[model samples]
Target: MHELAIAQSIVALAEQQAQNRHAAAIEEVELEIGVLAGVDVKALDFAMKSSVKGTLMENARIVRHDIAGEGRCGDCANVFPVNRLFENCPACGSYAVNILKGKELRMKSIVMATIGLQP
Candidate 1:
């Protein structure tokens, strides 16, 4: 599934970042996903659970932020909320609309594990 690939990429990114900073592990990771991004959250969650084995994000708390769809009507210049891309403008019922948001899938932040010297 594509979600597995996505999960793999996410884990790889976290590992790369942790390696760069020399962190022992990843504490947390925040992801921003838009409604219009065509991503299945359940599948991604399952994939991530299986993919993070022995990785830097194995114990990290993953947070997901769902972004609402927003679009502007080209005919009336009115902005409105949408759940899908095929939605027409609410103000003028125009099909010519430009999406202002809700097409994103990316990592927002990552919290690295602190390495302390304990004797």
Candidate 2:
């Protein structure tokens, strides 16, 4: 699955950030995944767990936030919740719907333990 690739990318990003900050280890990683992002959450989670092995995030806590899909009707100017893409507007029954959210797959934040000089 492509989720494995995505998970690897996430790990690579976290590793890069940790290296940039001179971190000793990564403590936590927060991810924001939208419902319409076309990713399998369960698969991504599994892939993430596998990808982090022997890495800085091996012991890190992974947090995921599920974002709901929202769309705005172009014809009626009505906003409504959307479960899938290309959905017709609920209020006007028009097919001109513009997506307002729920297409995100991003790393929101990372917590790292920096290497400190011992006295």
Question: Which candidate gets the maximum lDDT versus the true structure?
Answer: 2
**Number of backbone clashes in candidate 2:** 0
The residue ranges of model 2 lying beyond 4 angstroms of the native Cα positions read: 117-119
All candidates' lDDT scores? Answer: 0.94, 0.95
Work out the TM-score per prediction: 0.94, 0.96
What digit string (tens of lDDT, one per residue) describes model 2 on residues 12-53?
999999999999999999999999999999999999989999
Worst 10 residues of 2 by lDDT: 110-119
RMSD in Å for all candidates: 1.4, 1.0
| lDDT by residue (tens digit), candidate 1, 8-114 | 99999999999999899999999999999888999999999999999989999999999999999999999999899799998888999999989999999999986
What is the lDDT, from 0 to 100, of the residue 51 in candidate 1?
92
Model 1 scores a C-alpha lDDT of 0.94
